[model samples]
Target: MLMAMRYHIWTEGCQMNEADSAKLAAGLARLGYQEASRPEEADLAVVNTCVVRQKAEDRAISYLGYLRHLKEKRNPGMRIAVMGCLVGPRVDDLKARLPFVDIWARPQDFDAILRELVPENDLGGEFWPETFPEPRGPTAYVPVVHGCNKFCTYCIVPYRRGRERSRTIEDVRREVAYLCGRGVREVTLLGQTVEAYGKDLPDRPDLGDLMAAIHDTPGLLRIRFLTSYPKDMTEHIVRSVAELPKVCEYFNIPVQAGDNEVLARMRRGYTVEEYLEWVDRIRELVPGCAITTDVIVGFCGETEKQFQHTLDLLERVRFDKVHVAAYSPRPGTIAWRQMEDDVPHHEKMRRLHAVEAVQERIASEINAALVGTVQEVLVEGERGGKPFGRTRSNKLVHFPGEARPGELVQVRVTRASAWSLQGELVAAAAPAGS
Candidate 1:
């Protein structure tokens, strides 16, 4: 018997990238390649890179340099591949810079890489199969839409990932059904701007239509979609969340900045008042919805009053979670090409920490209010010797229980903190979608 060829993939960035890695891993498996524990042990090593921020790009470049050294010194026969945003649409410059790379693949383009590995075997059109060989976990991410059309000045996603493209409703439905059959209880539909799903499709179906199609999958207990654009989050989608029992009441809408001037500078396409109206509608339709947002501090030419406006918005919204980042100008973005990155690094960090401090206090207070309330938690797995999971509202809860993974349990909130909740097991609920 011959030993199987081993491969390793190192992934970075968002959930969409994670899904892409899973697809690549499955493709490698189909080609008779076994997974290696580390890059050093593999005959093929792939770095699925992210270049959204300057730091991420630098880290990826440094890792590639390490791999080059490893191939030269230890594993002379090892084949190297670089995929994702780092490679982008054109790789001539990258090819000249990183000559050691055997394959360079664009984001979500798995067929190109797989074909390069095994030239003779045709992958029969689509590289992503309807079902994977094994269940990944209790949770899975499925990309319903790819790329972005919105070119927010500070974002490189549009340039790297390209224009918006949505998978058909039936196609997405099939994937979700297959995942549920293999024991995935929770699915998060993904996109660069998730709310823009189905706009490009022939039937012109929206995300609400997509969610409605997938809501009744046999084993699926919860459905979620994320990184929504405020301008694209239609009333239909909000109503869908209110109507669908399986759909979790959670929204991850990124309000990049709070001030109108900063938002316009970023080309976000919506005003603070407009964003607030959308939030109000969501709250009115779906009470107790866990609203989370992303914020970037110290954009091009942001002043103290502008920064204070963001703080005011944070206080006003009191989001369940706030993802804060200091702006790092990426080359090829509009901000990099046209605007001066006038904010000093120290000032950026200061604003970032300030936003964090405000959010931390708000979150602590909001979670504290959940004490004594019963939350339905789908036990993901054991953490710190206790069963841990998230509520339908996406709040993390750790509780002492005999509940196993994939089992939904009713938990009584005992204590709450800024990040998570402490709970006591109340009862074991029936199987999800029962």
Candidate 2:
């Protein structure tokens, strides 16, 4: 018997990248390639990269160099492929940079990439929606939509992933059902802007409708969505989370800046007052819901007052979690061509630290408040000699438990910190027939 040829995939960026890598892995497995534990050991390697942040893009560039060395010296016969948004529309530019790379698969050209990887293997019959494998872990990500049309001035998603294209509700429903049958208990819907799901479709089934459909699935214990735009978030979507049994009450809305002028410059499309009103509505409708946000500091022309306004928003909103980044100019963004990167690198870091400090205080207080509450957490896996899981509100919790992964458990919060919680096991929960 011939030994199976091995392949490895190095993935960078968001959950979407992870899901895409999973798809690639499945496709490669079908073509008789086993996953290698290390890149150097593989006969072929794929790198799925992101260009959202300059630092991340730089790392991807460095990895390309490393892959070139591996090919030239250690593994002369190894084939290397690059995929994902970092490849973007500048294929020739990237090709010039990495002339040794065997394949270049842009985000939109993955099918061709698959064909190149498995030219001899024709044993396929609709492997995506109906035949896709279940997530090896309990949680899975389902992309209801791909790409974006919003074209926020500082962003590159639209140019990279193309215009918004949504899968039909039936398609998403089947995918979620398949995942549930494969023992996945949780599903998080993903997209560049998930709140924009179904807008391009004929039937116009929005996210609320999609959630209601998936909420009726047999084995799914929890459902979640992420990184919503405040402008596109409808009342129906909010009410669905409030009313749906399986949907988690967690929101991750990114208000890029707090100052209206700054937001306008970023082409965010919503005013500061309008965004705050939406936040207030979510809190009013869904009490105890955990609200998380993403904030960027040092955009092209941010002033001291504008940065202060962001800090004030953090204080007022009291987000459960905040993902902060100092802006880095990317080659293709409008900010790169139109605006001056005037903020000193040190000033950007200082602003990042300042906002982080305020959010840290809020996070500590919020976690501490959960001390006596009983939280329903789906036991994910073990870490630090204890089992860790995330509450429905998306807080990380660790506790003493013999409960197996994929089962729900009630944990009484015993100790709390800003990043994670320690809990005493109350009882093993058999949620959704787990």
333-355, model 1: which lDDT tens digit per residue? 99999999999999999999999
Reference-based TM-score, model 2: 0.97
- Where model 1 places Cα greater than 4 Å from the true spot, the runs are 122-134, 432-434
Listed per model in order, the count of residue pairs whose N, CA or C atoms clash below 3 Å is 0, 0
Q: What is the lDDT of candidate 1?
A: 0.90
Looking at candidate 2, the ten consecutive residues that score lowest on lDDT are 125-134
**Which model scores highest in lDDT?**
1
CA lDDT of each candidate? 0.90, 0.88
